[model samples]
Target: MSATVGSALAWWARTQPEQTAIVVDGESLDYQGYEAWSSRVAVHLRDAGIVPGDRVGLLAENSLPWSAMALGIIKAGAVLVPLNSRFKPAELRKVADDAGLARVIASDAVVAVAREAAGMGAPYEVTAFADVVGLRDAEPDPATDAFRVDREPTDPIAVLFTSGSTGRSKGVVLTNQSLLSIVFEASLTEEGFRQGSTSLLVLPLAFTPGLVWGVLMTTVLGGTIVIEKDLVPGRAVRLMEEHRVQAVFGVPLIFDAFSRTPEFAEADLSSLRTAIVGGAAVPVPLLEAYAAKGVTLRQIYGMTEAGGVATATLRHEAKDHPATCGYGSIFTELKIVDADGQEVGPDEEGEILIKGPGVTPGYWGDPETTAEVITADGWLRSGDIGRKDADGRIAFADRLKDLIITGGINVSPIEIERVLMGLDGVAEVSVIPAKDEKFGETPAAIITPSSPDLTAADVVAHCEQQLSDYKVPRYVVLREDPLPRLPSGKIAKPQIKQDYADVHVDFDKVR
Candidate 1:
């Protein structure tokens, strides 16, 4: 068995050296090329004084070299810290100070930014992007003989930073087993993912979903990972068509863009057989838009703590039960429990807890916080409120912290948002709690119109047809701009809540 990240890639290197491993920007690298290039990077890190258990930071735009650098760090027995590509100097400094990074490799555009962050307070080495990827077999390093893969499956291989939606961000520690085992077990059961499959990807590889799940999973099977240079709608479609990509993975927004692009209507998407759409609640209109093109959008649910993906809707099951994130994967087990910690019955709402091989041991260097989330019995508290049906299909409610209490009644903003999305002329909607004089708190929504004539009254009338009295959104704000989004591409709920926390809508206007 492959006990470490380097060994994981080494397994494929020995078995199928000539098989294409990654397809980046119209260029291809077979398993042999992957092994050679990654090994060269390992030698570079060794020359730079990296050691086992030391944290090395990666900061660069998503590209072939960026992925190889990550593997190189692992092969040299160092833990990788993937710095966010969108992070400014201050934000970058915080993580560098926290992780105590030994060195950071960055692109040309980011060299000054990374150096500025280090100049403020951090003392880590900031290596230019060229030095990391400039290696070749022309003049081999004598220190290459000293480099060895010595880490175990349980040892920390990476420290992934969360999206920081809930105040300060926490770094989630992951192991080789916590990551490699997920895709290994998944391919054994999922027909859509196998040794020869080809998947197109666009999300930044610095994040867990893009790197650990999408990149690592595809590479393990000797499959092709077609990395999109950018998220331009027309460009993504052209690459997918030319590469004959069989599967796709991204947040719902990326898929929605493809469906809306003028070229997508006539694009040769016959090669696409499966897709993963998550990172936020997917509206039915988004699903139907893809269905018309013979594609079924599978719902996926997971977090940074679970080592990337916990559950995914099968390609065949997405059509009938669109809301289901599907039963837990073979390596993961899901349970919904009430506040008292007792497991709830089918369809009974409660907090979601996960336990499995894919679960992380804990957050990096924060035992107190880790203990609060991970119970004594070993189940990891997901903090998401949801329910599982009798058949084991899971449906999300809302974040436990996001639940609104008005007149002592718990209100799920997600439920109301779903109903609002079903209404015509509503392009996008986010529901938040608005302070009410009489009720304490009432539901408020900010909506982007699908048509120019969409009105607050039109939204209220549609809610009346579907929701109960209290569930209806009392404050409806219509706008032409898109909702604010986090770096991970998920909607910025905290920003939304902050923008409308004290704003009140007149009862007469909404009526």
Candidate 2:
């Protein structure tokens, strides 16, 4: 019953040595070999002077070595801090300073950036990931008992940085118990996500969903994971067909890209039973398209603080309540509350509060901010507005900070966004608040159109038919390029709001 991740890996290695543990770029690692390889890496880390509780930074792209080194760091009793590979040196230095990493291991592709970041942050040694793997291979493995470090269920396992789509990123601390709880919940709730199942991982491993479910927990479940570095839709389709991937967890854009690929039409996706999409709302058309291909695209909802997923639409509800994020997850308790902390009735919009073993203890080294979010007795304030239907399904409204208060009327941007997304030619839509002289703040839709001729007038005409007068976007900005996205693939709403803060729509010319 030990919740430590290392124990899980060891158990799998003993029980199913020949099982395929991970596949990256067509190369596979069996569970037995994976165990020994991770053990060697852990022995090397200890020899290199890494101690228990030390925060070790990992900066690398998605690869087999990156995955092995992560388990190695955790097995060595160190706190793993996975850094974003896309971060600039300045951004890297900022997180390096915050985490106060004792050492950083970078892959060959990013050694230079990691070195520069180390130089700028608090003094910490930097080592190449390739070097660690090489050294471990050349040296003989230490006794299995030699690297054993007693770890408690509450001991910190990793520090994951939030995507910061709305603001500055914070390091969310997760313990072994927290992650294990989620793994248990997911295995029980996600149909077809079980032992021996093959999963396709396209999201960056640094993201919570990718690391928690795709890598760490998948290993615990004795499942095989196909890793894709660059998200080529055709390539992803091929991998799924080849590996018979059953559980696919990705954002909406990823699935959308797969649907556009020619390979997707003929690909044998019958093996795909748990196609879960989170990070953003799953378009109904996209869901229907996947269903036509004999795949049910379920919408999942959760945050870093909740581990990975707190709720996900079940297969039975996917057709009728595609908009809902489904009921609370197995181990998670969800409740809707008003601004004054009073519980809201069903069908009432309020902040969603989650309490569960999967929820994080607190943010790393930021008790003040942690106190502001997590209540004393337990519940974590989700900072998301939603409504629970009488059927117990939760419908996401919008981020509390993204709500538009136009003419003193609270408007949910997600409502407008869901409407805009339904229009033909609109690929992605983010509804933000645009300053208006008459209404104070009007809803503005920033659209990334798939069709070349998609115009603002067309968007307006489409919204007018579906939305109420105030709910209709007053301004529409069409961008030729894709909208800015976080690592989790969610639109950067704060950035969009900041970028268009000065945008104005003539009230006299408005509807």
Score each candidate by Cα lDDT.
0.81, 0.85
Estimate the TM-score of every prediction: 0.93, 0.96
Model 1, backbone clash pairs (residues 3+ apart or across chains), number: 0
Per-residue lDDT tens digits for candidate 1, residues 355-460, read 8887888988889999999999889998999999889998878888877788779899888888987888887788888887788888887898888899888888
Instruction: Candidate 2: list runs displaced more than 4 Å.
Output: 139-146, 505-511
In model 1, where do residues sit more than 4 Å from their true spots?
136-148, 505-511
Model 2: ten consecutive residues of lowest lDDT = 139-148
Query: What clash pairs does model 2 have?
Result: none
